[model samples]
Target: MSFSASSPVSFVRAAVDGEIARFLDRRRAQLLEVGSELVPVADALEAMLAGGKRLRPAFCYWGWRGAGGADVAGIHAAAASLEFLQACALIHDDVIDNSDTRRGLPATHKRLESLHAASGWTGSAEAFGRGAAILIGDLCLAWSEDLYQASGLGPEALQTGRVPFDAMRTEVMAGQYLDMLEQVREDGGVEATLRVMHYKAAKYTVQRPLHLGAALAGRYDDLAPVYTDYGLPLGVAFQLRDDILGVFGDPEQTGKPAGDDLREGKRTLIVAETLERTGSADRAEFLRHLGDPLLSAETVEWMRGAAEDCGALAACERRIDDYVAQATAALETGRIDATARSALADLVVAATARKH
Candidate 1:
């Protein structure tokens, strides 16, 4: 649907979508010359990009605008580049999480697995699926860089943005490793949870995107700290909302099966708080099925009950509320464009409080 009529953010979202679609169409045509078999990679990438709130681009666009950058086609393309980066992260994340679906459709790896099974491929469908997904994720990462470079900014401006762009990729990879380590160890409490959120979600999702936009507009030195002040809290709040949705949100809205995070044994603040507050029996029950792939719906509901009974859900909600307050406060910092500030205030709410 055309989101241009909804709001300023929606206009940015629609513009970003248009840029991404054009980029993918161009890429798909180029891939066709390689081989028909290669077309599925583009298809997977296209499908993955089709459904998202475009929040990263929205943040980037507003960041640029807040930095006194003109509203221009170049900034839109630059902002849209975050979508490709996000695609890379999502494809790789789904593989690592063993997620079956994303954006309410089979994940890239899962889709490939089904394709292999349907075609009666000669090898293990699981392995083939994973391998294909890895390559596709890499392709998206590479394309993200290309689009960033070609965002129509001058060489110096692109170079300015490159600093955060490079750092973001590195930080996200490290964050993913830390996340895996948390799953394996399964004992980090609130501190660990916040650290993971900082790298994995906060910086990568919001701060860096904002920095990239500001940098491209030649305002990095002045605005980087301000963006961080605004972006980090909002970003963490965004992920916390995601964690809540992973447990409590409807499948129709969240685009994942119920309790998928619980199935994955994510060491979220919710899990940590529940463990801290529950009685021994309730804690044991939660731990018993914390990471079980075979957890029944009844067990999932039971865990949800235990979380609520122990006040973990309420605690998480309180934290989100505080972070939202902090984020909204940060936007009032000196010298930001008034229009951008207002839109960003709206974004703080939209990012932190949502069904999906």
Candidate 2:
């Protein structure tokens, strides 16, 4: 049956919940045997797994459904694997961004810091937290692989999906490095920034997920181009929406302080366009303050205005619209089960329309 936006997201949630529960249950013996200290780590990991939109898993499920698979068992297991992979990514991403929160709670590292401080036996709480979070991320990565292996995909399907998953991890790391390098380099221009966006956010987030889903469904050769045509533009738009929220979203809703991206000095497309459009003096002032972690609200407001005034916001909106249109066109051309295609169409709309 086709799912609608109005359809309860509960069905998807239920599937994911089962998968995660099974994952944790299978690891319970190992986790318990580790020691008392590891309990908190497990708690932190569980917290990170709570309350995500499950977008990637939805993509995987629908991709399989689209290929005419009615194997509920197989689809549910694969979806859970996607969620686990996403968990791994988010844990590491929080470490890389030095973010303090996730889903309205302390981030993994920050939570570890709190635990370290509460224990009253820390030399360097910050270092301890970072090191602990790294290990936790590594554990999640390993568990994600285990879940994928246990998902019951045949050897052929497993081999096919592994390629994109491997590429997705490798490319995201490279893209992240490119982003960090852009922040430090003297000559990070518009082109360089866009390249980073495509690699870091676009390809890994959307393209690879779609490809992985299709590959698992035994439609890799036929569905590859469709993924490229649809996933790339939509992923870029998704990240651009994220950039907008990073600067302008409500903290209560987005689970982060407003203008967090500015504080981090993210050289996003909006920022890049603002720099490109501004005069030399204004550009220099922006450059000087872009990466200041202690930037005031007033300064953030000023940067927001500059972005809007320079047509950066408008340009981004135009690009988002163009990409959405391209994705729609790609969907039109692809042959998939009618019900599954409709569900995916709904997903595309809802994903692009999200405010946080």
Candidate 3:
């Protein structure tokens, strides 16, 4: 699966998905050798691995091409390894937020809890579920390293790519903690939300993946700033788009309940801006409903109306447009080859404009 820079985004996604599936299938066999109890572990991972948009790998692949790397299947495998890290982050995030569902299915903890209940061998199904999910998240984190090292690339390439790889994991964890802290801090504002968004989603989701690929191609020193210019703003726009969808998207499209982010009381830029723009009375009302576990459909609609009326949603949309403009300009002026630049330019729309 040696992809040219001209390869379609859909093609890249399919290739990475195939690599992930094959890699996990091999790992699943190895796990079963230990015992059948690990079957659930493998099954859960496999399920989680399904149906992602594969944006990280797409960025990585194009980054390699931009740096004048040869077309190679090994790069695809290395890029696909990032998916495991993403899975680890998502599983732990759900548990931390006490989320009910993900991608239209039970959150991993809830599913494990259900299994515990069905088996009738647990003191507390909820506890068992949470414990199992935590362990599984840990397992995915470990496997991310394993898959990257064994991605069929040489040791030198893997070693070269290690800096961004390690940094990405560390930053995402730190960002997630900051987000949790913001939830507790009653006066969380737009600046705090922006910081959390940058570390947790923006850099991890884009910049670092690009850096990892360029590093592997031996051009990291030259391309680092260019990648940052293109990736950072675009990544922020992408996450902002996601935040919008989390609040206003259809459940069938987003795979989570409507207002899930609101329910979790995430300090998203949208929420922060909306709070700032609302009248004092309306702001007070918003806070009362912010993190209510039993929030109602009617109230969710009211919150949507409040967000719109306050101009927060429009403001956020303008911010996304501005960031995207910045990134698009970077793509034009940056020192990247034509084919790779075109490929990357194609990705900007897909990343920020997706429904889910």
Candidate 4:
């Protein structure tokens, strides 16, 4: 379960994976105690957890390190808890977006649906799959809290970290709701899109993780601002890169079809900017294919071209570069240690410039 990276927090990343593996093993055994029918629930969760760069845990580790916290099993378990939370978000998000695949495999809901069909179940397979996936997400959410409680940290330390832990959960849900609203309202302005991105991903993915780490170290009051200064812009840049990859990234690398975001009717910054830049007639043409589920490769290419001609893609790239710069500047605040500073610098590239 370990992931090897050149970053300074690679050791922490491996430790977090070890923690997650051991925790899941316990969970799997408990599930089996109920019945063999529950094995697929464990399997789906493990499969979904198999991918990802483990970015969040790394940030949390560095946050702790920056705040002068020692490396320990408790922190690793605490960081591992974030992975369960992430799993909850991803599973439910796939259901909402009707994503067929994740990480080159059938999404949780689709997997359950296929199982229901193969078993010749009597009920609606689609509904069964969706319902099962939703329950799995709920289970993951509950398990996140369970893992946190089992982290073995003292009451004081756990209490400190709980602030950001709780805030991250609440903010992510709020952000997700805003994202849902954006999709429903077809709101894609810079302001609306950024507002959604900020709460949904920016704070949840980066800021709060860092805050969690610092909080556990009992240095939240001292380091909270620095974490935010670095985390917020970096998170936005990371998601902006994700938006670009959603549109133009290689399928082999991203594990998603090219232009999948467009097909899903995502009101991403790219789409919003493109709409703002195009003439009314061009906007109409672009909107026609923006969310076409059966969208053709030819049309995707045209939209790509249109986006390029309108400079929306280039504009996003520029913003990514600028935001990365802002995040980098925040690191020079003379608050973080040398090791944490250097590792966080490496993360800027990992977060904002990743392929998947």
User: Which number leads on TM-score?
Assistant: 4
Write the residue-wise lDDT of candidate 1 on 1-356 in tens digits: 11222265686987888889888889999999899998777788889999888888988898888899998988989888889889999999999989888988999999999889998989899999999999999998999988888888889989888898899999988998998888888778788988999999999888998898889888999999889998998899999999999999998898888998999888888888899899998888899999888888999999999989989999999999998888888887877888888878888877876898
Encode model 3's per-residue lDDT on 67-168: one tens digit a residue.
988768889888898988999898999999999888888888998999889989849999999999999999889988888888888899899999999999
* Candidate 1 global Cα RMSD: 2.3
lDDT of 1 at 253: 92
**TM-score of every prediction relative to native:** 0.97, 0.94, 0.96, 0.97
**TM-score preference between candidates 3 and 4, better one:** 4
The superposed Cα distance between candidate 2 and the true structure at residue 298, in angstroms, equals 1.4
Against the reference, the lDDT scores of all candidates come to 0.88, 0.80, 0.88, 0.91
Pick the lDDT winner.
Answer: 4
lDDT of 3 at 123: 99
Off by more than 4 A, model 2: 1-3, 6-11
User: Model 4: clashing residue pairs?
Assistant: none
Off by over 4 Å in 1: 1-8
The TM-score of predicted model 2 comes to 0.94
Model 1 pairs whose backbones collide: none
Report the alpha-carbon TM-score of model 1 versus the true structure. 0.97
Tens digit per residue, CA lDDT, model 2, 208-308: 87788788888878887877888888888888888888877898889888788888888888888889998898888888888788999999998888888
lDDT of 4: 0.91
